[model samples]
Target: MSHSGILTLLTDFGLSDPYVGVMKGIIAQVNRSLTVIDLTHHIPPQNIHLARFALMTAIPYFPARTVHVAVVDPGVGSDRRPVAVALGSDPNAPMGFLVGPDNGLFSGVLSQYPALEAVELTESQYWWTATPSSTFHGRDIFAPVGAHLASGVPLQKLGTTIAVDSLVMLHSLTPQRTKHTLTGCIQAVDHFGNLVTNIPASEVNGQTWYAVVKDVTVLGRKTYSDSAPGELLAFVGSHSWVEIAVNQGNAQSVLNLGIGDAVQVILNQPHSSQGD
Candidate 1:
């Protein structure tokens, strides 16, 4: 908190390895005063889509001027370009910064924030040490670049500006909707066993509905304990998305639901509080 700005780290590298430590070491060496927060280090190796989703969920919670450095690159030694991105309305706006490969990891972030500005991390000399390992640029290249940016160096110094359309974006998962039914798939399962679905709350027209996951139908509730303390229920999450959870237990374990599982929301029937 002592630093002028925030620098957050997100990576597919698990915490057991020295990779996260090495990246932090490089950043600390450059700007000791900068505050560094670890958004996540266990992102399921090489899962760029998962990384993208995690970044989208975590970045908005941080204050403005937070630099987010994400490294879920599976194409480290390949032709993929190392890049830095900023998301905000104005090109000169001081907001979020993303450092990673030009893979589809930026997809979710770009979708959420349309006014995105990006640039390739082109200055090799600005990178740490004399020679950077092609495989570990997270420590050698990205960390140093992030540290410099967190220290107030202009983003234009990172590289030449580019069009937002030029950046790579993955195809987003689509939510299917009918007259009174909305179908979506489980996008992710967090450590807590909460099934995060692709369905956002905005898509639900009614206050109550039936959340059918797999073959089990859980009555939609407004809160975790809308049923009983240990009962399974559905609720609109803080992210404004519907999630199936147990009040005092793990829904993923109790119901055996995982990522990519199908979920359906059936709207309430006339004169009935719950959907059939």
Candidate 2:
């Protein structure tokens, strides 16, 4: 199917179980012709920060009016309201719908499109079942509501309007910087064992800097291949974040670093040029 009538899913429910399939089934049941895209079912099991980051990276590629349903809800069935947000007040901004729990899973996407309109998904009739299972609202609540939105249900009719300001925000854990040092924590370790940090690519600037990992000092390079095999290399990763990797090797294994481990960039001197 083409991207029209699109509904995207992002969740921590791995494909090893039937959870992802069940949600797709519910969405299909609502509108079989609607194109349902799985952004990912592997979001580190309620790691909302990672889910938020993934959304920001992926949403830009979808067509306007695509409905994105992300469910990394750790507070599922709690007071955290299910929500369907229509992104952007500006007619020129890419129009779309974001459906999920109001627990900040969409915070990264929301941050980029600041004029979005949101609503609490309180209307039971819009859900797949009136009596939703407490733990699996992804199937009962989010899937159906997102399907309906893709099926042409009015966003306002989904529930009461909410102030965009009222939506929960994930803690913005930005990197700290001083005159010579920039400090950040590893936010994720990817499948290849590259350490993704909170440090922006703008911080590194392709300049001469010391990457302080444990007791080792490696210079920041513009690409992974700039370092020799098995050497620790710091580079601006594909996600535009500073990442630590071992060329042709795994940094997570070699450096013994995981998420939340500190990675520092100590500048030797200011650079003559900046990097994108």
Candidate 3:
């Protein structure tokens, strides 16, 4: 494994604490020349679901071989395994490394990229220290392993090879489609209080659609602006997921919708008979 020169860190550890900084320092100590990027540190504390979504969305834009370190572990100091896994398979597919605990945090990325190889981080030499703290493996284990991976350490050298199937996984809600409706659930509420659904934008491509949930319905539009203040607007976010927002209000506060809340998308245009 040659050094990729780029590494990204994603964690629920907020900037208010020194945890994020310490992890970065560990990585920097391993490879001084590597460019380190922060994916996000404000992940809402133990909110691994959003962390998964964030990484899955951000991974596509990174260059191949860029090592990604995600430390959203709520199971620290437990029996949970610290692991690093390589993802993607196609020769032209965008593939990279995911170093973190074997929690559901990396499952969203796995849904997008096939797991090529995986290993349990049992080797102490590749870790930050041989006597790692029971807590804060993000600083003790994951950070350094990711740094070593970016510093040209082979995946196999860092830990014992393990079956990808043995790794824990996360299952996101799958959107369902009928001739005139799309059934999905709210996946997350973003910083701006946008209600993000699992429905893909392509589900409404070339058709008119409206989103309904919790007795509130909103028109589908290209943007959530230009509407009257406090009016709801449903649109496709930059991440390509259907999102509901208010013109000048907080959708989460206004709509009172949250993760796992059911969202029904009603198609207004004529239904195509070709696929029916």
The candidate that achieves the highest lDDT relative to the unseen native structure = 3
**Candidate 2 Cα errors over 4 Å, as ranges:** 1-3, 91-94, 268-276
lDDT of 2 at 187: 75
Candidate 1 has which clashing residue pairs, if any? none
RMSD in Å for candidate 1, one decimal?
Answer: 3.2
RMSD of each: 3.2, 4.2, 4.2
lDDT of 3 at 29: 92
lDDT values, one for every candidate:
0.81, 0.83, 0.86
User: How does residue 224 of candidate 1 score in lDDT?
Assistant: 73
For residues 183-266, write the lDDT of model 1, one tens digit per residue: 888777776778778889887646557788766777777877568776778777876778888887898998787777889887
Q: Give a tens-digit lDDT track for model 2, residues 1-276.
A: 222599999999999999999998988888899988888888888788778888887988989889999999999978998998888676444388899998888887887786467889988898989999999999999999999888888778899988988898875566788989998888777779898888877776756676776756766788877878888778888888888888999989988888778887888764332221
Name the better of 1 and 3 by TM-score.
3
| Backbone clashes, each candidate | 0, 0, 0
Flag clash pairs in model 3. Answer: none
lDDT for 185 (candidate 2): 84
Clashing pairs in 2: none
